[model samples]
Target: MLRLRLVTWDVKDTLLRLREPVGLSYAAEARSHGVQLQPEALSRAFRAAYAAQSRRFPNYGRAEGLSSRQWWLEVAMETFRLSGVREDAVLALMAENLYRDYCNAHSWELLPGASETLSCCRRRGLRMGVVSNFDNRLESILLRCGLRHHFHFVLTSEAAGVAKPDPEIFRTALRLGGALPEQAAHVGDDYSRDYRAAREAGMHSFLLHGHGRSAGPEVPPGHVLPTLSHLLALIEKG
Candidate 1:
């Protein structure tokens, strides 16, 4: 029998895949303000700014931090500057609309075998939860994706006041789910944020290798599974 008490999952890039082109909505909004930007250009600028802001946020147990929405707001503003879009109001509106859409958007595809694996975990009597580095709107997004019911606890960085790579985020999930660290497992696509933090917190860690080759000196030593099904098999075997 499996010894796990809880199974926690990361949100983006692990369970759900974005279906629509990211910048298409931004491009449409830009056009409304008489600005013309290639979608690819906008996407690149947005990604760069987003990553920079995330890095600026306090790592681990710092008191000061930006919520995912606040961080993305800065990214959107900076991206507007990078794209030479001069309208502040337009940028703000786009940011608000895009975030709202993201919460309610079904423009995503759940990964193959994800539902089956989750169901199997549930049937095995393992309580499931989510510990994600995201804004307050993460619950709404999960609900829209029909995943809200699957998780007993959903902790976001905004709600927890600590982001991943910090043991506190994982601890919070354990506390909320009434599971000890040793009785849990965390699976995510991020090596540093998920694998390293989960293991440090005394939980088993699994790196879900999705898209992109593994790149980084800080990648953790853990089971690297290509698909959610593989993880399910490991859990079952344990």
Candidate 2:
């Protein structure tokens, strides 16, 4: 029997999310400036921008503290740039506005039943920590959702000096959990970042595919648990 003592989690999309698709927030913020762009387009652009920014600033947390906001501003600008907003002035304006808008707590909410899952883990005596590719704002966000108490520590990419899928962040979480890789489990929604990365780090990983099933012959077997409730059951049974 495998002994498990620690459980580390990814924050965004795993524990909580915006009430609507992220694009809606982008659209809403853009509309205030008389900008009319499709949310779908903006969504794609935003993801691409964030990914690119990550590659450019692979060691953000080690850099100046202001790097967080600067990185986000770059991503926001890239979103507009990809959306066909060619004017530099307009792009800068949108980036600043959108960055400010995202900082507000009104833009996010806890995922359904997430609290119950965390509570269940607590009752099971599992040591929990958080590993995420987020900025400093993440601590405040978790606190607002009443999840701060459940986690023993929160490790963000901006603080770990590394992000997910890189394995460095997972290593940090393990250190915080005070367990060997085999004695801990990692949970997240991203396949590569959470599943593949944790698997490579020698930790058991659970992929939570919310709202549907995604298993296929090509997909790796025995990792998709899909719901926090199922994850809790597995940890409890172990």
Which numbered prediction scores highest in TM-score against the true structure? 1
C-alpha positional error of residue 120 in candidate 1 after TM-score superposition, expressed in Å: 1.5
The TM-score values for the models, in the order shown, are 0.87, 0.85
lDDT of 2 by residue, 1-238 (tens): 3478899999888898877776777787778878898999989988998788767666453465557877788888888888878878877887888776665677778777789989988887889999998888888888876899999999998888777899878888889889999999998888888888988889988888886757445335456666777886665455
Clashes of each: 0, 0
Over 4 Å off in model 2, which ranges?
59-66, 84-90, 211-213, 216-222
Model 1: CA > 4 A from native: 55-70, 215-222
Clashing residue pairs, backbone N/CA/C < 3 A, model 1 = none
Q: CA lDDT, every prediction?
A: 0.80, 0.81
Across residues 196-219, which tens digit of lDDT does each residue of candidate 1 receive? 899999998888886766735565
